[model samples]
Target: MKNKPQYAIESVDHALHLATLLQQEGPLRVSEAADRLGVSRSTAHRLLSMLVYRDFAEQGGDRRYQAGPVLRAAGTSGAPVALLRRVALPHMQQLVARVRETANLMVRVDASVRFVASVESDQVLRVGDRVGRVLPAHLASGGKALLAALPPHELAELYPDPEAAGVNLPKLRRELGLVRKRGFAINDQLTETGLTALGMVIPEPDGRPFAALSIAMPAVRFDRDLLSTWVSALSTAVTATDRDLAAAPVLGQSRGS
Candidate 1:
């Protein structure tokens, strides 16, 4: 049987345990954490605060502590995620050069998408770095691109009840269908007013990847007539990135750990 160390450091143990809980069980409230850790609410809060400071935990909109980038990145330690960022940066930079807009690399996180890398345009009106930001999968172009590639059963699993999740199933389905047909997706100020993005899946050979590439720009600068040109640039970057991912030592990683 496993045995605890005789000289165990209780506070260290508690903090580590809390981090483990956040990594494994998703979000947790202060009271819930106290209950799970067998400690008082204040102590639990302190531990969570420390974790947050270290980027191991984050406070969600609902005031629950969830896994932060350090805990959730590439679903492992810094190595795999660093590898992903390394492999995607060059292509992303090229995409930004071609489109003269911001470019982002993201992976699906259940009903959301997390921007892992972003290259901002030189233009003063361009979008900013989106790293570590999360947005609804149905609203973000990269998220929609990744979502469109999932199998139906997996899609249903991710969106059990679209209405309950604040998603319009009928409309989302139509958009995903179009993405499948055209090999890309679009977000015309859906996530933020005056912002628009075009995205395409970054293919992975082993399985469907919850990953994609996108180009974001100010709405006024988005030229509908240039849709083909933007898509072509993103498609080329996605292709090169995908080709590199195929032979990489590290496998593709996505959100939600």
Candidate 2:
């Protein structure tokens, strides 16, 4: 085996070590962190404060520190969602190759949708890579698919006042209804002018959709005649990805922790 590097960044390493402790042991006290890391109380306080600001740690009612939302999310890092992304990659590539369009896998985060994986079309005039880009859920095809899949109560929570400032509640409801009936979502120049995209939701084990697979292509090359074909291909790809995710080992579980 190759030798490990001798040099390491002390502060970054310390922060990560603290995060690991939180993940393994749940809540932690400043003194505990300090003793375990062999650092000063002041250093531990500063480190924990940084975690709080970054959403990885939180102060509880008793003023002790506990894992926050970000930390909990980290604990489940072996989450199936990561497997979903990995299994979806080949399907995304196949979708791009077959449909001559950019393919993406996306998930909703609060009011926005984030593209986690993408396969760009080979054509020079194709859409660019969408990975790491976030956009309004109401405007993207993938976002609409996931939003449509939400339960009524959850939907209400997500958009308490659709008519609230800068929002058009009625139109969004209508679009979501259409998505439910059609089993897919379509974006026609909504996110980007002259671009059209179609998306299909991928359901989790609980039957709630947390992600979607989508294809984006230029409007100039779009045709009503090929929509059915594109939808079929995309749906097949999404289904295969979902199945693989189910069969694959859970992220952390597979690592023999």
Candidate 3:
């Protein structure tokens, strides 16, 4: 192993160390990164911010950081994510056009959902691109849809210690039940105060939920009367995207953006 040089720059060392940790550990919260780096939370945040600016890291909706495009591009695991993002973009764009609302694609990673791809709407007050954002699987619309696809045993395992995890198991179960019945999920001001989202799961060839698609708009623009129209359009886009994903040879394994 190489020894640290006497003249090494501390800030640069911390940033590079954080990048390595992100690539190896998947995602990290500011607190976690701070503790690992033996630095203040603010210092960790600044370092992570710098990494994000250079595309070496990305911030999630929950404020966690993960490996960004530059690092991802240098690794083998990025193949599926890159391909998934690429394959899903055209469909996301079409979905945006259909509803004039922002569209997002996300994949579940443990208890969190990562926004892998997002297409913004043309509206003046639309939800922005959420790519590289992470959110709780129980709170986000797309996440709930993916969660609803989990087998009972798997979901039960997800909340083995609900209280410790700050999860309301019963409430989540009811919401997931509704998602299963409706074939979609409605995150009505749940993820954010003024945002409403409708989400559906994109399937793997084996019919398991691989990822999810969502339409997000300002709550002010949402009307109950538009529910059917939104769902119909989302369903069409989901079907088309699903068909294309199934036909892609590079996507032989389950992948997410």
Candidate lDDT scores, in order, read: 0.80, 0.79, 0.83
Candidate 3, residues 1-257, lDDT tens digits: the string is 11245598999888877886686457899999999789999999999999999999998888789989987864222224545667888988988998999999888878878777778899877787676566888988999999999988899898899998778998899989999999999988977888899999987766577889999998999999999999999999899888887778767544442
lDDT accuracy of residue 164 in candidate 1 = 86
Give lDDT tens digits, candidate 2, residues 1-257: 01113586889878977876675445778998999789999999999999999998999988789887886763132224445667889888888888889898887877678677778888877887665466888888999999898877787787777766245877778889999998899989987888889999987666677579999988788898998999999988989887776666673244334
Structural similarity to truth (TM-score) of each candidate: 0.69, 0.67, 0.70
Taking all chains together, the TM-score of candidate 1 against the true structure is 0.69
Off by over 4 Å in 3: 1-79, 253-257
lDDT of 1 by residue, 19-115 (tens): 7667644789999999978999999999999999999999999999999998886342222444567788999999888888989988776778877
In terms of lDDT, the poorest run of 10 residues in model 1 is 74-83
